[model samples]
Target: MQRWERRLSDAAHALTNCGETYFEPDLFRRNVNQFLTIIRTVTFLIAKDKANIPDYEKWLSSAIGKYWSGDEVMLWAKESRNYIEKEGDLELFSSLSVALVYSYFTENDASIEIGRSELLSGGIKKLMRLAEAELPHGVSAAAAVKIERRWVANTLPNYELLQSMIYVYSRYRQACADLAEYLGIILSTTIPTAESIGEGEVHQRRVSYVKFSDKASYSKLTHRVEIDRTITPPIWLKDVDRTRPNFEVYAEMAERTFLHFGNHLAMVFVFSENGTILQHLAFTPFDQVDKFIFWRDLAERILYLRAESLIFVSESWVRKDPGLLTPIAQAEILGEMLHVHEIKRTGEVSHKAWDIERVGDQVSLAINDNDSLEASGFPNYLVPIREAFTRIHKR
Candidate 1:
């Protein structure tokens, strides 16, 4: 264990200076990749095998002799003895303590020895205290750093506990990175254009759509007599107030419009767009509308939904709009509102206008009628959407 600790400390120092020492981007990337891979592998191994073991007493003694050569090892041993006495289970408590220590070492190798001592000295109990700290507005990154700092400060004292802590910290870091990447992809992409709609000013419009099926549960007579036939409405139309006009209203409108019209399911798509579809959103409907809306609420809270420009699509709509819809439109609206797109005719939509020359059966709306508008000059938003569709769909 002591040899491993020394190796880890040496590796950390090497990694920290790799870019400066090597002066190579590829080497830097490779080193970081290797470090991350090793961290992950060690974490998995400890979690799966050694997490329940007692402190490595023999290993610690050998490490102290080989490395410490001072009173530091004696103090650590005394603290470990006290911890074992209080916990009543040497194996479990020591293992957990050692895990916490390893986490600190991996993150901050310079303070590895001090970090080990902190873990043994009841510093880790401060996790709850730090967790209770108030976070400032719009300072999530800072807050996260603070929390990690406090956690590391509290856990760094115990050398034996380092492995387990490393495992947990690595998992958390990976999860956060994954989430950030997903959000980046969504926010950085261009907004999708709707078919047959004229380009209009970009507004944060809350939009949604619902599907009605012939196999709907509600009776036709009830739908026709009680509800306005023109307004293909949901079964629970009375619950929504479209006058206030917000995301909640849009969601309710979809449910109320589709509930009683023999529709088995309802898929909703919403985005900021102007044209006949946006204008006609008021009259859509469904059958069997439940007031306690779960899926819609969940969808609204997703990262993509909160993005500056996001499109929501229903599965039923995707089937109808297949081969003509752009990727943004498909991503936002399909599956949630409708199923995935099924490709049809090849080269029905041209990529030339978008600065893309690739030709294939990519699904995109025909811009033939709008060529005159293009000649007259369309908005810049359309250009990116067209280019993205061409680049993305050419597989």
Candidate 2:
């Protein structure tokens, strides 16, 4: 690869992998310095090649005046490289702590912003609380903890390490493009913009599951119903024709899907007559409003797609006092079936299912609540767990 090509590849690789080793301070520091070195090398190579120009000094002054002089980020990038090479690893202060959970189901028992030094000293176990932002609402406690870390350099405290590196990399890459364009030389590869490579924090979110004593029951709580979004289109669907519909084949596929996701939370699969999946929506939302919007949109999409058969399965929280699922806005849809299972905090389960069908161009909702209640006891750990986490957070 050419110099510009190699730099782009390295920067892209660095940004993509930075999150993997972000918490390891030494590895992170070395990565940061290596990225800074890329900036320096790019600058040095551009300056060295100026000897080829007839009025090299004039061009150099013009380029600096145009790109570097006024840009604080570019100026910082230049100085940061020099500083790190002479002064050892970049000075970084990092901390990993749990961001407190706030949801409709759980009360905000703890409301404290942990200081950086304290958070670092506390460690993952010490900072774990009753719940986390990533966990769905209504579980007695968080099944997974979201451990957040921010790496800030001593010199640049305002912006975290990832953001600072992105800005620096972007500024230098732009300079390379501009210099090449000015010299009328065609580069080997297209330069990618910062946003395309990732402009924000290098590592976005990291979730680690907290093991509980009742492993089987807690597994159900943590198990989110989802179709792997990363999946490519299945080969079987490739031959299905949208113009000609086959409702029978589609219905079979929908039944298989229901069996797969029946135990978990939210899911909707809409299929056309020829067995092609028009849309498969499966996301577990923690907020009530988002859940409402998700179902409402599902209903709208079914109508829009003119789906032959659709399966909608959802899990809901039931109020122990009322023995009823908590009120959430519902959207009426003409579908094969709507199955809703409810779980109370105390580990009791009840269900209300409806057979939704189209009769003479009108939709009918026939409700059935004959399903037996499941008495699988919920783990008796909330009180002790909450107390333990509260004590940790306080300390």
Candidate 3:
């Protein structure tokens, strides 16, 4: 590897570390723009040489061309590179024209006028293919930098994790919104605690309560007194969790509501805070959640659910029953705390915020220097995430 190619490899390494920062796009973009400057140098250094292969030609046409070229895989790097320099993205290219672009760039089609002002998809693909085809020839320009295929080939393990997290996060936001609205209409109030309820009035109350684990038992509780002239039955509340002491408080309130209101009121609904207990509410039949459940370590469940909601509605793919996610949508986020991590070049993340702080949705990252995660949030998203670990994590 020559000095320049080696530099390019280092830059790509930095680019791969962008995974830890993916949760914060602006930071990722900032870091990418900086590292690309180093990598783009390979493009220029090779541009000056006229030999078996230039650095740009050699690097682009490497064995790992496909992974490096895919838009979804490297959108951040490519778009950031283009936008940083040109102040815009390279426009989508026509697939049909890929061959033409290839022929023009690598053949006799220079007669065709291709504008430098715009980048076409076909052109990019053609470039990648040309680079891939040229793999047989090394940079005859005397290893400007001793670079190898390894620099850009390997997939960042955590990169996939970030993608999955973002996938779930987006879904959770959408699903939670719809579920919140549903809860607003269905729930009489958000008060998890009331002033007080007495044993004598408990039977008189027109409301009934039951634990989630004991949902079947709710029907047995009958109103012992007809305190109201109308003498209606009570409303029923399905507290999301009965294991917690707080569950009793909610149950008593439901009983109080029933003692007052009677009949046509036994609607069993769970609060959003009990997200974990509401696992029964996870509705997606085909989803990443199940994969995590069966395959991954149990401790990572919180990481999955919090970063990507356990009951995520999953972006624009709307469900006919957002009600399926009611357990997560109702709770309000009270506050948040941010923690920064240092993602080493080896793809290992270490604690310690290299000066990362939440400036907006992103942090102040200099060179993918910090992998910051702002963890603390409202119990609605947290409850289920926490509960999942307790339920599934190996003891």
Candidate 4:
């Protein structure tokens, strides 16, 4: 590789290393400074290569004007490197933020703010108590919680260090590409993909408590909680190894709010397209305290995913029973413009069902299924429900 290419590769390597070292504060700080220095070196190499290329000074000056001139982010990157080399290591602000995930929380809720030093020193044990004290009226601890540790440049406090670094890396990558094109030099080394750079936000952790657990079990679980408290984060779920298949499925289900009517159901699956199951949720029955949670979460997920079809495997009682009717209505309102297929279940078999759908301007749930799910273009949806019923009968 040429001198300019080598400098560009070094900058990329520094960025890759910077992302991996967020958990190690000292190393992370060093990597950021190295990344900044390498970025500056890329342009410096271009300036020195002027003898080989025509009008080197004019082209380099114009390129700088086009890329880095008047750009605050790029200017900051240059200044940060100068500060590190001349004065000292770049100063950074580190912080830890704790967010409690409860069904009752609305948009008005705010996450608890804790200093990095306080959390790292010995604040992990206080998480539960801190969370409970600020919980709203009648609310205890969260069903799930998210904790994030972030670092930002003390000068540019608006952007997290990773985000700022990613932005600067992308800018420099473009500048280098333009310079190479101008010099008619073909790069042998491939640039990093957009997805790799976009993953800069994954600096957090998550922990969830079991639903409907007794106080003793909850307290015991809380006492054993340990936060590495490093400058790092995740979605809400129990203390399960994410590498495990079951935990992956559980996390996806929690994120998607995949649901089923009864606890006895063997599996609850959400399909995206072509019968591919997006999520296979555990059919855990909600008690009285959290029954509303399931419907609300499910509705929110439906809206978020912009899902068009919904096949609900529900017992016959859910339709005629007054107590079960409210949640169904809530689902309809929140999940508007949805084509709903309600498969009514009897003792051992599912009967005909109804199709609730949008009509012109308004949405309606009308009884319309004259045949079984197998005949209604939804044979795949019926398979799991039948399998669950088969298992229950065998028991």
RMSD of each: 25.9, 15.6, 28.7, 17.2
Clashing pairs in 2: 246-273, 246-274
Comparison by TM-score, 3 against 4, better one: 4
Query: Please, what are the lDDT tens digits per residue for candidate 2 over residues 259-288?
Result: 443434465555544455555567776544
> Model 4, 1-395: lDDT tens per residue?
66877887888888888878876889898999899988888878877877887887777676566445666667888899899899988888777765544444323234667765466324333544554566543343223333456788887886577767776776666567657778787664466632244334343221222332232211111111223667232333344355643324433333222222111232334443233333334344443224323443343333222222334443222232224224322232322111223322222323333343445655444444554545645443344343333322232
Worst 10 residues of 4 by lDDT: 216-225
Candidate 1, 260-354: lDDT as tens digits: 33222423232321211111111123321211122222222221111122222222332233232222223343321211111111212211111
Error of 4 at 170 (Å): 0.7
What's the TM-score of every candidate structure? 0.16, 0.40, 0.21, 0.46
Clashes of each: 58, 2, 31, 5
Name the better of 1 and 4 by TM-score: 4
Assess each prediction's global lDDT (C-alpha) against the native. Answer: 0.27, 0.47, 0.30, 0.51
Best by TM-score: 4
Better of 2 and 3 by lDDT: 2
The Cα error of candidate 3 at residue 131, in Å, is 50
- Where is model 3 more than 4 Å wrong at Cα? 16-29, 40-76, 88-395
Q: Sum up the clashes in candidate 2.
A: 2
